[model samples]
Target: MTANSLELNPVATIQSPFKSRFGIPRQSGLVPDAIGWIEPHAPWHRAEAWAGIEQYTHLWLIWQVHDRPHQPVSSVRPPRLGGNARLGVFATRSPARPNPLGLSLVRLLAMEHQAGQVRIRVGGLDLLDGTPIIDIKPHIAFTDCPPNSHSGFAQNEPERLRVDWSMLPHDEALRLNDHQRLVITQTLSLDPRPAFHDDPERVYGCPLFEFDVQFRVENGTLFVLGLNPFP
Candidate 1:
């Protein structure tokens, strides 16, 4: 390895409903019902490695930025700024930086050990399915939660667009359970359309869990066209 570089191995893999990046929330902790888990690999699956871990209610996940990790960009157009102005990559949390790493604070729901295999259940996550987890750290409120922090351009949470699932057939709607419904609604509320690409007549398809979510946006409202099982 180079002097400034180091090799790292993924300790776990994330199992999340977000199959693709199209509909994932821009930030973590936005969707409370977006449940997922981290299954440790090989030697990391030992129970002793997770001793006393249940004491913490939340954790910080250090993961890879998947698709964007291989690409490099010096500047980026932030969707929060209407995608009109470009800012230095370091100024914003764009995944196209030199080191494509992502950090998310997730609520720990459970820690299970079955036959020496370990899984960490978490909620309010924004990671995609099969994302590689490099490290996990407990959330320390005393030091991590800094008061009076400025958000810069993103002064407030992204506005949620009103969603209309009326177009979905009764039978198809029944396929989604309560948790799935919340995940879908919460994911759609953020308006997953690309910032620079706003085509009211265009149909967008997002992969959520095992279903292909089809929808369209018109006049600030998102209409669910259909939900088809992933073949």
Candidate 2:
């Protein structure tokens, strides 16, 4: 390591229900009911490092795209445009970047310290399980949420599809609570499918908590096919 070239070490790792990248939301806070946590590593494991963090309502998580290798490229496709348009890497929030770093604003739910271990529970996890957390900062509304900001092509959040759970089978010991059900609903509404995929006949599965949610999209409405224990 050199003075000019900095190396980032993870302060913690995220514990999320999203076991894989296939069904995770493209962005955080999209599914407000989704719950996750951050477990501090050796150096940051002390409870003193997380003291008073509960006072804040939300926090900014600086993480990395550890699941995939970095693709060296100047331009990439934004999924919002159906993966048809190419833009500079910096212009889009794609994980295939020079550093593979990512930032997310998540709502803080609770903080717990048990036996010298500190765990911070959060909501709206778009990250995969065991993803490294580089840094954490409080979200300042005045600075983070600037007024009249122009987001170029992504001026607004993606459109949500209607989720239908009427077809989900009850024989599978369906024991999802209200929030868990809402998490599924909100997750599916964001339409996790790739922008290029438009096959209404195709079925997709997303693992949430302990169950695998199966579904398909037809006529703009997403239908819940069934649920199986995550394998």
The prediction achieving the highest lDDT against the true structure is 1
Off by over 4 Å in 2: none
lDDT of 1 by residue, 1-231 (tens): 789998888999999999888888888988888999999988999998999999999999999887553787999999888899999998888878788788899999998889877899999989989999999999999999889988889869989999999999999999999889889999998998888777888989988988999999988899998998863
Give the alpha carbon lDDT tens digit for every residue of 1-231 in model 2.
797688999999999988888888888888888788898898788888888887789999999899987776899888988899999999988888888899998999988888987889999888999999999999887788888889999889899999988887776536887778888899999998989898999999988888888999999999998887887
By TM-score, who's the top model here?
Answer: 1
lDDT of 1 at 210: 89
User: Which 10 consecutive positions of candidate 1 have the poorest summed lDDT?
Assistant: 64-73
lDDT of each: 0.89, 0.88
Candidate 2: pairs in clash: none
What are the candidates' C-alpha RMSDs? 1.4, 1.5
What's the residue-level lDDT of 108 in candidate 1?
Answer: 97
- Cα displacement (angstroms), candidate 1, residue 47, comes to 1.2
The CA root-mean-square deviation of candidate 1, after full C-alpha superposition on the true structure, stands at: 1.4
